[model samples]
Target: MTIFLALVVGGLFGFVLDRIGVTNPSIMGRMHALMNLAVMKTILLAIGVGSILMFGGQMVGLVDVGHMSVKTAYIGVFVGGLLLGTGWAVSGYCPGTGLSSAAGGRRDALYFIAGGLLGAAAYMVTYPSVKAMGLLEKIGGGKVTIGTVPGSGYDGLTGLPGDVLGIVLGLVFVVVAFALPERPRKGEPVPVAAE
Candidate 1:
């Protein structure tokens, strides 16, 4: 049932990405160039809505806090994020969008997926050596959340209530998304997929 639900959700997500033009490399490239903000607005809206619902649920005791997983922070995490951003900008495909793009019949997205797989394999093969170099060492015990979790020592940097903080930040994102101009600037070329 869980797998079935995941497939349905994944399909829906892909459909949304496709409909929003995120499956196109040209659109993504223009987003990176700041020539387009549709993708950014969409992402911000998602984040805002998700954060609000998640934190609101927690506040109402409707969500299971125990099920939440927060990744440990470390140098490698930052380094990995930088690499991921670089890959996204260069290849014009993040993992999720890349998969969706490939599913939508983009040949270049397939190559992106192949390169990602190779990169993952290389990382796995070099894990031991990387660990030995202290790349995986936990800094300050690593695991943390933006807000205080019951029975956990980590209260993040601000030591604020997580749910409240999440809601505030989420609303901020929502506002920013709405504030962005939808139309391209004068003289800006509209992005289009190449034939």
Candidate 2:
């Protein structure tokens, strides 16, 4: 039953992403360039709502917090993050979104998909050396969260949880959404059609 619910909810999420043109390369590219904040704003909204619900559930004891993934906060961590941001700006898509766009029949999305696959393949081929040399686990660190580990008898953040921060942050996005004015894309003259 839990798995079933997860599938249904996941499908709805994908549907929303597709409907919102998140699968579009142009939109994602603009976001990477910092010209469009829609993607970031949407992400914050989702995170905010999800965190609120999860924390709310924990409060009522409807669900228990689970173990978090291991932390790897070494130098490589920041380097990888910056590289990802740079690549996203240059290529206009994250791995998953690039694949999504490619599947949706966008040509430029193909480049992103290709790069992602190449990176994955490279990782697989170098995995042995990476692990042997400790390069992979170099940045592995603490849990690094506001809450206690599971079974420690302490619930995750209660009221004013991390989600509340997201909620507040999300409001900033909402405000910007209204404040920003839309403009035509580059090389797309507003009078092109009329001319």
Report lDDT (CA) for all predictions: 0.84, 0.62
TM-score of each: 0.86, 0.67
Candidate 1, lDDT over the whole model: 0.84
> Which segments of candidate 2 are over 4 A away from where they belong?
1-7, 67-71, 128-141, 147-195
State the displacement of the C-alpha of residue 133, model 1, in Å, after optimal TM-score superposition: 2.4
Clashing pairs in 2: 74-139
Instruction: Write down the TM-score for model 1.
Output: 0.86
The candidate that achieves the highest TM-score relative to the unseen native structure: 1
Give lDDT tens digits, candidate 2, residues 28-68. Answer: 76666555666666765566566566555555667565532
